[model samples]
Target: MTKPKALLIDVTKCIGCMACYYACKEANKLPETEKVEEDLSATNYTVVKETDGVFYRKLCMHCNEPTCASVCPVKAFEKTPEGPVIYHDKKCIGCRYCIQACPFDVPAYEWKSNKPLVKKCTMCAQRQKEGKITACAEACPTGATYFGDREELLAEARKRIQENPGQYINHIYGEKEVGGTSVLIISSIPFEKFGFRADLIEKPLSDLTWEIMSKIPNYVVVSGVFLYGIYWIINRRMELSEYNKSKNRDSSEDKN
Candidate 1:
């Protein structure tokens, strides 16, 4: 089997350049506005933010077991074997379930469109199929964002941390958080300082959702039986009332 691919982002190496941002916009065919929004939006698949002299890049993490894929009733989001969590817009029902289910809050809705679709990074699946890297990674001049096999990238990140202990924090963000993401980050400072959520557990978010969903069949069965009993009781009462009324009417007619 082919090894899954991944992206390793070293926050210390980033220069706060918007090359990856613009490259994402151009690659996704999004319109270039006069002014760029500093936050992630439908048009902006990736954004670079600088806080306290440290630059942090934000985009879809693409979990190994994606909660977005789990919560999507229409199965619009799919985690492909090749490594990308791809979205099929045609199958989407505009429910926004995936947006709510994501741990990183990555997916954004198109508020401007009459029929909006959830938008986020695809890890350049099409480009990968063509033996090319992601546009963002390709446009990165400083090589902050490195793309390769997931395991290989993990090894590289560990080596960098081990070799230069003073340069980066001991932990590799996204290494095990939410069951390991396709995108990994190694930062010099604490991740929480850069607006990254550090409260997430190591287990996959989808597991919790599946535990709840597993009870759905039981819920349906109990509800169905309860509703049927109510209907039956009402019908029986109505039939008894009609029979009593008919008997009274016959007695009156016979007396007349």
Candidate 2:
């Protein structure tokens, strides 16, 4: 199997130029809004933000075990072997389950579309298929966002932190959070400064959901059997009562 790809974002190197944002819009063929949006939305797949003088980019994490994929009733979201968590708009049911299930709150709905679908970054899967880098990564002038094999990116992230101990926070976000994502980050300051969820557990959210859902079938079967048993007992009692009333009338007639 081909190794999964990933992106490593070095927040210390980002300049908040918004090149990635525009590149994403062009790649996805999204029209420019009247005003530039600083947040992730249906039209904006990726965005760069500056928080307290630190710049960080936000987009889909493309998790190894995506909760969005698991929660999608129609299987609209897919985590590909190529490392992109892709969306099949044709399969979407507009249930918005993926939007609610995503821990990062990444997915957005196309409220303006007559036929809406969930929207988020696909890690430029189309471009990757054509052997091209992601539009956002390609447009990054400062090399703040670099794309490569996921394993290689992890090694590089660790190496950078080791080489310059004073320059980084020594933690690589996305390396283990939510069971490891394809997008990783190394920041000088805590990721919480960039509005990242630091409290996320290391296990995949999907696993937790699966653990609960696995027992559902058993629960349903047990409840169904119990209900059927109650119905049978009630019906039998009615039948016996009707038979007893018929025998009493027959005895009264025989006595007369």
lDDT against the true structure, per candidate, is 0.92, 0.93
lDDT of 2 at 214: 96
lDDT of 2 by residue, 82-123 (tens): 899999999998999888878899999999989988889989
CA deviation > 4 Å runs, candidate 2 = 229-256
lDDT of 1 by residue, 35-84 (tens): 87687788888889998899889999989999899889999999998799
List the lowest-lDDT window of 10 residues for candidate 1: 31-40
Poorly placed runs, candidate 1 (over 4 Å): 216-256
Q: Best candidate, lDDT-wise?
A: 2
Clashes of each: 0, 0
- Which pairs of residues have clashing backbones in candidate 1? none
